[model samples]
Target chain A: MLNELRKIQKKHGYVSEDSIKKLSKKTGIPVSIIYGVTTFYAKLHTKPTGKYIIEICDSPSCYLNGSLDIIKYLERKLDIKSGQTTQDKKFSLFIDSCIGCCDEAPAMLINGKPYTKLTKEKIDKILKKCKS
Target chain B: MQILRKTDQKAYAKAKKLGPKGVVKILKDKGLTGRGGASFPTGLKWEMVLKEKEKEKYIICNADEGEPGTFKDKFILVNNPELVIEGILIAAYTIKATRAYIYLRGEYEYLENKIRNVIKKVKAKTKSKANIELIVGQGAYICGDETAIIASIEGKRGQPRKKPPFPTVHGLYGKPTIINNLETFANVPLAILFDDWDSKLTLFSLSGDVTKPGVYELPVGTNLRKLVELGKPKHKVKAVYFGCFGGCMPYSNINLTNENVCGKDCMLGAHTIIVVDEKHSIVDMATNVAKFYEFESCGKCTPCREGTMRILNILENISLLEARKRDLETLQELAEVVKETSLCGLGQTATQHLLNALKFFRKEFEEKCR
Candidate 1:
């Protein structure tokens, strides 16, 4: 059920109520249960997010490797705080618990593709690619 | 340097020749155990699943290695996925399971394509009867628990069901199921091929403040200091955080064997080590680890959900110098409650690292507290 919602979010940017209702009807699960599942998972977004979602790893290993610095850099560069989508709806940034990339710490996933060993210049280049 | 090569079709054939009971016997003789940190006897688990009379038994390879700092499974998938597929086949054949699923983690989106290709190749080569499928998780750490993983596969919320009807009897859509960790399954083929199973080595995901921080295959019951030495520390190591938030032990207690790391005070849950040098702050590390549990809690029960959040709050207070001395006592007491009352291993062991930090590095917390 969670995977189905994630697929829907992947295609549509967020899980709309109509999709949820349709999913509930198709799967024979209650709408409340669907909502509950969606809300319980961190990756599943209810409302529409931006074109690109930036998930920064903020767990201990990543934190020790200066993931916070990358988050702060992204915030300053993108002019939006963590958990906020851009005013132009181009990017939404948030801190993820851990992406299982501790070896390559200071990692973030831009639209589910990992960017590891991050630097300010690398972040600039990544955002530039997204812009284009 | 390469531990796993091609599918080991010869080993697979030999294992298949040995009937299910014979295979189980070999597994028992080999002393193979679950690499997912529980150290449950693999042979015993397979024997139990094989004995189940259910017609629709299932086998699941738990590739959801989301435990922080553990990526040995990813290494296996990337480099030697065929070995894991073969392991799954052996288990399926032994248990007569008609279906199997590899529950891959969501963070490992990159490895999906490679694993899918390997699965295709292995299926074509072996012509196995079991219908194998890959189920991708949507970012939740609790789903790593076997029951929760089963629930997730059933298209429900990834929360654990209370154990009495364990997965061996009622699992994966209410049929008998067998789930093994990725590394555990990877070891199956090796156990079949090699006779010296007693000396078989296991992979350790080593990282953090080490010169060569990566996966190392070491003998079972290897010492902590020996494993750390493999990584080549960058500085004077003050402590080692063994087994994926398992627990923290000071440098003085470095002489630990794999079998004994989970003593009365700590656990070596997943065999993942994160070295903490002298420069790192213990308070900050504990706070970050607590924050992880708080965020990842499935909220199925109050003790885990509330306890983790409360622990995180107190840790944050301590870090900011706002916590009173009494908060330390409350933190310890809260950890005990969560460990005792939580529904799943996530809650039961969530406070382990925090508790270890408090036990060994109380002065760090004390310095921060008023």
Candidate 2:
């Protein structure tokens, strides 16, 4: 069911009520239960997000190594806060737990691709690359 | 370094010759333990599943390495996947499990293809009977727990359930199951094939305020100072946290072995060493960790959910200089209750860092208090 939901979210940018209903009808799992499962997980969402989701690690190792500074820079550059999507829906930002790249510190995953050892300039280049 | 000192498929071939009981004896003689923080005896755990009368059994390789400071599992998976796969095959054969799953964390979605390729190759090369599959996690830290991982696999909310009808007796789909960390399984072939391999060698993920931050495979009883030096601290190391679950210890003479650290009133949980310099405030670190637990708590138990929330609030207040004199005592009392009353390890160890901070660095918290 999670794999199916992920597939739907991959296509639609997020799991919608219609998708949940369709999944329920197909799998015989009640819509309410599927909705509950959707909200229970951090990856699954009920709302639409931007094209690229930026999940930055703020766990102890990353935070101590200045992940907050990276987060602040990304927030300023995108003109949005953590957990917010941009007006054009090009990007969404979130505070992730540990993506297990603590060795690099100041790390994040942009659309599931890891961007490690981040600096403001690196973030700029990444954003520019995303835009291009 | 080979994670298990050897990663050849010869171990699987050897295990086939020795059979289940013989392989269990090798693991027992080596005294291998789980590497995913719990340190439960690996041989005993396997033996439990072996003793079960149920014929249908399942094996799960827990790759949900979500603990705040731990990344060694990722290193092992990426660097020594063949060993992990061979270990998995050996385990499946030992317990007579026909199905096996690798519950890889979702953040590692990039490695999915790499792991799948390795699985296909290893299974084909071994001509194994177990049907191995990889199931990626959907972002829940609690799913790292055994029961919770089972629940998530069953397509339910990833919440932990009561144990003692343990996973060994009654597990996935009401059948006997054996779930072990990927690293724990990686050690199995070492126990089976290598006669002189030391079971004490363990991986430590060292990060935070260090010049060289990465994973190091060292003996279990390696000194804390030596482990930190491997990372090359830039400033006077003030404290070290053992993967956020073991609580923190002020810079003092300590060792990294489970028993040695446990004797010093800290846990070497998952063997993750986060070296903190004197420049950082303990209050800030505690609040940061508190917030992590609050966010990750599954909300099944009130003590854990509410306790972590309130613990975070208290730590944040302390960090912001808005805490009262009694708030310090309140924090300790709250931590004690949360530690004693919580159902799962998440809640039980939630306030460990703060409690340790208050014990070793009370002055820092008091200075911040109004």
Candidate 3:
């Protein structure tokens, strides 16, 4: 069921109500059940996200190592808060749990790829490349 | 690291030669425990499942390494996929399982293809009956719990279930199942091949307040000081947080083991050694941990959902210097209640670090309160 939801997400960038209804029709599963699974997970998106999704580690290890600074920098640079997407729909920023990169500390993921040991300059370079 | 790096099928070959009973004996003799923080004796766990009457047994490799500061399982999977595959095969063959699943985390989505390739290669190379499948998690940390992982795979909300009929007897669609941490499975081959592999060495995830932070392979009884020193601290170390399962321990010459750390009311869980330098505040660290639980709580049980939010509220007030004197007592009472009444490990250990901080560093928290 999750894999099917992921397939729809990959194609549509988000799981729409229509998509959920269609999936429920095809799978013979209840729409409420499908919605429950979709919303239960942290990764699944109910609303449309930008082209690129940005997630910074907000757990203890990263917080101790200056992830807050990196988060502030991204918010300022993207002109959006933690859960908001940019006006251009180019990026969406979120403060998520640890992504298993504690050794590198202060890490973020862009479109499912990890960017470790982040600094303001490093984030600048990453976002600049994302824009291009 | 050396033990985890070897990809030889010597252990599998040895297991095949010795057969099921002989293999369990070898694991028992090695004194190997589960590396996934539960510390259950691996041999005994396998023996229980093997003795079950159910014919349709299943094996699960718990690759969902979601603990905040722990990544050794990811290290094992990325560095030596073959070892993990061989370990899974060993478990399947031992218990006569017809199928197996590797629940990899979605955050580590990039590793899916790499792992799938390795699985394909391993199955092709071995004439095994167990059909192995890799399922990526949908970003729920509670799924790291064995029961929760099963629920998620069954297309549910990934909430942990009550455990009396443990996974060994009843799990994964109600048949007898054996779910082992990816690291625990990785250790299976080593235990079969080497006589003393369990006590010789293990991987430690070292990070925070250090110049050189990475996974370090050290001896079983290695002291916390040695592990912290390997990270090369830039400032004097004040305390060490063990994965968040184990609370913060003041910097001392304590061995990084359940026996050693347990004496100090801390657990050496998953060997996640996070060094806290002198510059950081205990209240701030505790608040950060509280916030993590608040975001990750599944809200299934009232205590966990409400308790985590309440703990965060109190910790936030403490951090902001607005906490009343009575708040400390209330926080202590709440921690004990949540620890006792909560449904699963997430809520049970949620307040552990906060309690630990209060225990060892009460002065810091009191100064913030009236």
Candidate 4:
């Protein structure tokens, strides 16, 4: 099962359906259970997950700090909504709850690194360099 | 996925062994209180979990520290994951449980990943004889409560239930379970590493009116006066809004000091302290906090569901042109009910901030209510 997971990893990318299913088998938790869990939870995904799943905080503070317009700029640049997959399949946008970095409001995740106090121009610059 | 020793806190030592018995001893020595908003006795909580007679026991570290003005758990979990990890290990050992789980907030995906990575590293380096699972809660405030946390971890939506057959007796898979806050667990590593001497390490995040608005680690007896003095740039700190959710104190406490302050002395939360700066409107701050509880109320029980919405209505009235002196009295009455007679701790304790803010700054509340 481990070998099959490795082969699947080699064939696909970082995350795979078989690997998630294998985790289900190893844990004695049903395959569908794992599938449901992966899908139900916003963080987990069955398919290959991007290295950077940028989640822009759309909470009130971020909204006050102009996160919606920032999201629009991101959508135009990446050509996708907040939770949709991109064409390049490199970046995926996650509509996040309050990131709690309200002091540095208008925060977003870049490769799991939280970047706060963002502007449209700054976001564009970050996107140019952000991989996934 | 390696352990990050990069903590701003004064965390230097590592506890090689702090099994259940050692924890009891430390609890006795430090007179350590629970860090989960409630300053209840840690020893008593331990006794509750230990008294339970169940073969399949569980230990859960509550990393869902989601109080709006609080980020103490995030700091510890992100910068110093081992502190909580060591604590979780000790809890599991004490409860005689082979399975330990850390339940974090869904919105805190970044922090959750931080913990998950550390768990992986810990598993790889040390042979985890006990099976510890890292679980993320799907965005619910009530999950901060032990019962809801248990439900969420068991692959179910997080919601509160009756608690006479408390979590210690029947939790997670109909087994005895122990759940504690992140700061509580972080303290465990200190209990293990340090001599059983009484000392407290604090992480106070100074925001709003203060000069520095970051998490600061200090010692036990530091006065709030000195702490505020340190936070000042040039202007005097007019007020303070320390702790989160459940407990709140005066603005003068933050103004009073620049030295270290411990748990039992002041109104700081389990591991967080916030100072409201001069420029930010305290009225606006209080109203925003009131609205936060109103928005996050899980609507499980009557006292919380309707009460919080009514509070929101009053707050919106204050924001608009309909607030009255009677509204303040009604808000206070509702706060008492929500604090005392709610289904879970969220509603029961959610009113603490609003009440504290209003009580401390009644003039501000009165003025806002117009």
> Against the true structure, whose TM-score is highest?
2
Per residue, candidate 3 scores C-alpha lDDT tens digits across B191-236 of 7887546455788998888989888989878988888888899999
What's the lDDT for candidate 3?
A: 0.87
Q: What DockQ does predicted model 3 obtain?
A: 0.83
lDDT of 2 by residue, B1-370 (tens): 7473555589999999999999888898889998888888988988999999987899999999999888888898788888899999999999989699899999998999999999899988889978898888888999999999999888899999888899988988778888999889888887788877788888889999998999998998888888888899999999998877889988777766778778766788788889899999888899889888989999999999998899888888877788997899988999999999999888888888888889999999889888
DockQ of 2: 0.86
Task: List DockQ, one per candidate, in order.
Answer: 0.69, 0.86, 0.83, 0.14
Report lDDT (CA) for all predictions: 0.84, 0.89, 0.87, 0.64
RMSD of each predicted structure: 1.7, 1.2, 1.5, 7.0
Ordered from best to worst TM-score, the candidate numbers read: 2, 3, 1, 4
TM-scores, all models, native as reference: 0.96, 0.98, 0.97, 0.72
The TM-score between candidate 2 and the true structure equals 0.98
TM-score of chain B of each: 0.96, 0.97, 0.96, 0.82
Q: What is the interface root-mean-square deviation of candidate 4?
A: 6.3
Docking category for candidate 4?
incorrect
lDDT by residue for model 2 (A1-132), tens: 777887887799889999999999999999999999999989887888999999999989999999889989999999999988999999999899899999998899988889999999999999999999
In model 3, how large is the Cα lDDT of residue A81? Answer: 98
How close to the true structure is residue A2 of candidate 1, measured as C-alpha lDDT?
59
Per-residue lDDT value at B238 in model 2: 98
DockQ for candidate 4: 0.14
Sliding window of 10 residues with minimal summed lDDT for model 3 chain B: B1-10
